[model samples]
Target: MASVFLLLVCVGTLLGSAGAQEAYDRLPSKFKLGVDMALEMRNSRAGVKRLLLYFKGLGQSDIQPGNDVTYIYHNFYMKATQCPKGTVDTSNCPFRNIKPEIDCAICYKTIAGKIQASPKPYINCIRKPALTEAMKRKRVNYCNEMGYSSGAPGGLADIGDTYF
Candidate 1:
C-alpha cells in the first residue's frame, strides 16, 4: 500500500497527457535497481514539493482507522482500471465518487522502447493504445527514435501497463 500510494502520488503529477503520438519527441529513459522516488521527483518538470503536497492532500484520507491501506489502494487500482475504455475523467474511478470527475490521464502514460534495464523511464503523454497496425508501427518508430538500433526490440507502453 505504501508503495502504491507513493507511486500514485508521484506518477499522478505527470497525468496531463497529450496522447502517445509524440512520445518519440522526448523519449526519456532511466535505469536502476528499484523505484527511485526521490530521483524521479527531482527530474520532473513539476516541482517535487508541489507533487508531494498534492498527493499528500489526496492520500491523507485513504488511510482510515482499521481500514487497511493495502485494501484501500487495491480497491482504487481495481476500480480505476475497470473504468470504461477511452475514459478521460475518472468519474467512476472510485478514487473519488463525487460529482467532479478526476482526470484519467493520471494513469495513461506512454513508454516507447524495450527496457534496457530496470526502472525504465517513459515519455510524458506520448504513447497511446495502438488499435491498428499503423499505430503499432508508430510505437516501433517511437522506440527507434529513442536511439534504439534496427530490430533491437523496443515498443510502446502506457502508465496503465506500468502501474495498474
Candidate 2:
C-alpha cells in the first residue's frame, strides 16, 4: 500500500511539471510579442532614473472573452536589465542584481489580430522582496529556452538559492 502511494505521488509530480511546461509552450510567438508590448508600454511612461526591465519569468496567462471583445492577460516577472531607456535591443543585457517586479497586463487585439497598445493595455508592476523558488526556476527556464542569459553577476546562484 505504501509503495503504491509513493508511485502515485511521483506520477502526480511529473504530471504537474509537464502541465507547467505546456503553459510556457502555449502561445510562444504571441507570448514574446506580448512581453515586448508590455515592456515598451511601461518604458514609455517611466522616468529617466528608472532602469529598464526585461522578462524574467512567466506566472500565468489566459484568454477570455469580455463584452464581445477577446482579452488576453499575462502575469509575469520583470527584472531590471540595467539598460538605458530607448536602448531598443537588450537581447544580451544582464539582469540587475535586485528584487524583481511582478508585472501583470491585460491586452486586447484588433480585428487584424495585432495586440493594440492604445486603449493602452492595463499594466501594473510591484517590486517583491524575492521571487519564490518556483518562480526563480521558471525564470531560469524561460531564459534558457529563449536563448537569453539568466541571473546577474552577483545574484543568487543558478540552482540552490531560493531568492533572486
Task: Estimate the TM-score of every prediction.
Answer: 0.21, 0.47
lDDT of 1 by residue, 1-164 (tens): 99999999656534422221122123223211111222233325342222110111111001122222110111011011223333444322222222222111111112231222322332222112313445434433454333233222222222122232
Off by over 4 Å in 1: 1-46, 50-141, 147-151, 157-164
Candidate 1: residue 161 Cα off by (Å): 13
User: RMSD, each candidate, Å?
Assistant: 18.2, 17.3
**What is the alpha-carbon lDDT for the whole of candidate 2?**
0.47
- Candidate 1: minimum summed lDDT over ten consecutive residues — where? 69-78
Give the clash count for each candidate.
4, 0
Q: Residue by residue across 1-164, what tens digits does model 2's lDDT show?
A: 99999999767655644443344356455555666676666677746444455444544343333333333444566555556667755443444556456444333342235655544444554556543556545643442332222112211123223323
Off by over 4 Å in 2: 1-27, 46-51, 64-69, 116-120, 129-164
